[model samples]
Target: MYKIENLSFKYEKDKYALKDINMDFSKGDIIGVIGENGCGKSTLFMNMTGILKPNSGEIRYNDEKIKYGKKDLYNLRKKVGIVFQDPEKQIFYSKVYDDIAFTMRNIGMNEEDIKKRVEKALEAVNGSEFIDKPVQFLSYGQKKRVAIASVIAMQNETVLLDEPTSGLDPRSTDAVVDIIKNMKKNGTKVVISSHDMDLIYEICDYVYVMNKGEIIKAGNPDDVFMDEKMIKNAGLKTPWIIKIYNELKNNELKNGETKEETNLKTIKTKFAQYK
Candidate 1:
C-alpha cells in the first residue's frame, strides 16, 4: 500500500538520520525494521508517515506520490497512520473514548459512527473496560493500548507501529502482537520498528537490519537473521530460536531454513535418545 524509494533524511548539515532507504508495504504483511538505538528506525517511520519529509527521496502511498501540503497531508494521514514508541506522544485525551474518537472527530465523522468505531477499536486492543476510564489512571501498558486504539479507530490501510512492544511486559507484548496479527487478518499492512529480534523473528514476514542510519540487510527473516556475521555487524544478536538451533546443530545452518518449527525439529532429532 506504500512505496518508499531512495528515501533519505538528514537532521543536520552532514549527518543523515536515514540514508537511501527503500521499502514496500503490501496489503497483508508484517514488516519489521530492526536496529540498535539511534539507528534511524524512528526517523524512517516519521518520513514515511509524512511527519518528516525526506531530504532527497520520495514516498508514494497507493501509487501516488505523497505531497506534504496541509490538505495533502491531511488526506495522506487518513490512509497511513502511526503509533509512536511512547504512548504519551500519541495520547492527548484525558479519557479513553475521547482519545480513540479524536482522529475520527478530526475527520468530522458523525457521533454515531464515532461511537461504533471507538467501541470496535477498543475491542481490538482488548480495552473495552478502559473506554470510560481516565487515561491518567491507566497503567503504562494500558495507555499504550489506548494509544493504539486511537490509531486503529482510523482504520488506515497501512499502519506504522514504532516500538509497539517497547517497555511492555510479556503478557502485554503478546497482546500487542495479537492485535497486530488481527490487523493483518483484517487486511491492513503493519510496519513495525523495534530492536527486539525475537519478536521480529516470530511475527514478521520480512525484515531489514539497520545500522548507522542505513539498511545493511533486507530479506525474509531467515536470510536476515540467520546471517550471524551481518546480525553481529548490525549490533544485534540473532533470535534465541536461531541461537538454539545453532548450538544444537553444531553451528551449522541446517537445510537453509531457520524457522522456529524447522529448528525445533532439528533440535529434537539431536536428542532422539530421549524417546
Candidate 2:
C-alpha cells in the first residue's frame, strides 16, 4: 500500500530528523512503529501523509509516485488519514457531529452522503452517543474517539495513528484497541506509532524499531521483541511477557521456551508449572 525509499528529512540545515529510511507496507497490514521521543516517528508519518515533504527520496502508494504538489498531495491525502497524538489538536468543530462531518464536507460529499458516512463512522468508534454533544465538553477519551470516527468516516485506504492510547485509563485504552482491531478486520492498512510496547505486541502484525532517526530493527513482533539489547538500545521496555520468558530461560526452567512462545498465557502457564 505504501513505499518509502531513502527518505530523509531536515527541519534545519544541520538538524536531521530522518535518515535514509526505506519501508514497504502492504494493504490490510497492521504495522507498529516504536521509538523514543524525537526518533523521527512523527516526522516519517507527516511525510507519508504529505503534511511535510521529505527533503529527499521518494514515497509512493500503489505504484503511483507522490509528488509535492498542492493538488496532487491533497488528493493523495484523501486516501490516507492521520490521527494525531492529541485529539484536541485535531478537533475544531463545535459539535461532535460537525467534527465528524467536517472532512466529508471538505471533500465535497453531498449532504445525504455525508450524514450516512458520519453515522457509520460514529457507530464504528462507538461515539454515536455523543453525536450531539459539544466537542469541547466531551472527556479526553471521548474526544479521541470522535477524532478516530472522523477519520474512519473518510473511508481512507490507509490510516496512520500516532499514540492512539496515550493518557487514557485502562477502559479507554481497551476501547481504542478494539476500534483498531475492527479497522484491521475491515481491511484498512493500519500504521501506528507508539511507545507502548504492550499495545504493539498485542495488535501489530509487524514491528519496526527506530533509534537515532533510523529504523534499527524491523520484523514480526516476536522477533523484534525478543532482542532485549536492541529494545534497550532504542530506549523501549520489553513487554512483560517477554521479560518473564527471559527470566525463565535464564533460570533454565523446564519448558523454558524461546520468545516465540512468550505470549501472556504461555508465560503464565510456564510460571504455574514451576510453582
Candidate 3:
C-alpha cells in the first residue's frame, strides 16, 4: 500500500545512499529487497519509515503524499513500523513486556490498552511464555522475536524488517518466518531486506534485486531468480530451485516448463522422474 518514486537519499554531501529508487508495494504481498551490504537496503527502509527524508523524489502511502508535519509524521509512523537488523538497536528495555510496550507508552496509550496490545503482540510472536523474562537472559532467537514483538505491538499496517533472520538459527528463522506469515494472514503487509536467498524464495511473492542503490530486477521469485546474470550482478546466486529447474529443462528433460518448487523434498521427488 506504499509507492516510492524517484526516491533518493544522501547521508552526506556528494554521497547518495539511495538513488532513483522506484517500487510499488501492493496490499497482501510479501516483498523482498535483496542486495549486497551498502547497496542501500537499510537506507531505503529508513526513508520509507520517514526516519530520514529523501534528498529528492517522493513517497506516497494510500494515494496521499507523505507530509513531514509533526501530526502527519506521527500518523505515518503509526501506519508503518520498522524492526532493525540488530535486535540490540531496537530492544532497550530489560524485560520482554516492557520492551514491547515501549512504543505504545511513548504514544500515550493508556495502561489497559497497552497491556492488551503487549499481550497480543508477544503472543503473535509466540514469545508470551517469557513475557516477563529479562532481555539479557534470552537467546539470540528470543531476542529477535522480542524485536519483532515490539513492532507488532504498534499494530502498524506495513512492517519493514531489515535482515530479520540474519543471525537466527534454523528453528529461529522458521519461527520468524511463521510470524511473518501470521502477519500476512492478519493483513499486515511485510517488506523484508535479507541476504538469505532461500528464505526470500520461500516467503516473498515479489522480489527486488538491488545493486549500487538501484533495483536491477523486480518480479516474482521464479522470474527474478532465473536471471543468472542479474543475480550475479546483484552479488547473489540463483536459488537452488531455479538452478535445478534450469538444469533439468536444458538437459534430457525437454519440452517441459521449469518447476518452481522451493521445498527440498518436493524437488528431490521431481528430480526422480528424470533419473
Candidate 4:
C-alpha cells in the first residue's frame, strides 16, 4: 500500500533525523515500526503522512508519489488518518462528541451525517458511553480512544497510529488491541510505531527494526522476533513472548517428545495466555 525508497530527512544541515530508509508496506495486515526513542520512527511517519517533506528520496502511496501540494496533501490526509502518541495534542474540543466531529465539520459534512459518523466511530472504539461526557473528565485511555474515534469518523482507508497503547492500564491496552484487530477485520490497513515489543509481536504480521535513523532489519515477526541477540544489538528489547519461547526451546526435551510436538503444545499454550 505504501513504498518509501532511500528516504532521508534532516531538521538542520548535516544532522539527519532519518537517513537512507527504505520500507515497503506493500503487504501485511498490520505493519509495525519498532525503535528506541528518537530513532526516527515517528519522523518516518511524519514524512509518510506529509507532515514533513523528505530532504531526499521518494514516498509513494498506492503507486502515486506524494505531491506535497495543498490539494494533494488534503486528499492524502483524508485517506490516511494519523493518531499521535498524545491524545491531548489531537483533542481540540472539550466534549467527546465535538472532538470526534471536528474533522468532519471542517470538511463541511452535514450535521446529520457527522452525528452518524461520530456515533459509529465511538462505537468502533467502544467509547459510546463517554460520548456526552466532558473530555477533561475522562481518563487518559478514554481520551486516547476519543482521539482515535476522530480519525475513524473520517473513514480513512489507512490509519497511522503512534504509540497506540502507551501509558495505559492493562484493561485499556487490551481494549485498544481489540480495536486495532477489528480495524483489520473491517479492512482498514493499520501501521503503528511503538516501543512495546509484545504489542508488536502479538498483532503485527510484518515488522521493521530501526536504529540510528535507519531500518536495520525487516521481515515477518516470527523470523524477526526469533533473534533476541539481534534485537539487543539494535538497542531494542526482545518481545516477552519470544524470550519465553526461546527459553523453552533451549531446555532439554523430556518424555521422548518430538521437537515439533513439544513446540506446538508450548507455543499454543503461550499464545493462549496472551489472548
> Model 1 scores what on Cα lDDT?
0.87
Winning model by lDDT = 4
Worst 10 residues of 2 by lDDT: 255-264
Best by TM-score: 4
TM-score of 1: 0.91
TM-score of 2: 0.92
Q: Of the candidates numbered 1 and 2, which has the greater lDDT value?
A: 2
lDDT of 3 by residue, 1-275 (tens): 89999998888899888889999988237999999989999999988877888989999999999888889989998989999999999889888888888889999999999999989998999988879999999998899899999888898999999999998889999999999999999989999999999889988999988998888889988778878988998888777777776765565346444454244456647856754
Per-residue lDDT of model 1, residues 178-273, tens digit only: 999999899888999988898898789889888999889888887887799989988898888778877756634555344443456565466465
- lDDT by residue (140-235, candidate 2, tens digit) is 999889999989999999999999999989999999999999998898989999989989987898988889889899998888999989999999
TM-score-sorted candidate list, best first: 4, 2, 1, 3
lDDT of 2: 0.89
lDDT of 1 at 66: 89
Give the Cα error of residue 63 in candidate 1, in Å. Answer: 1.3
Off by over 4 Å in 2: 253-275
Worst 10 residues of 4 by lDDT: 252-261
Which of the predicted structures, 2 or 3, would earn the higher lDDT when compared with the native? 2
* Candidate 4 C-alpha lDDT tens digits along 1-275: 78999999999899999999999996697999998898898899899999999999999999999998999999999999999999999998889999999888888999999999999999999999999999999999999999989988999999999999999999999999999999999899999999889899889989999988988889988888777777987778887767767666666344434545345347858679876
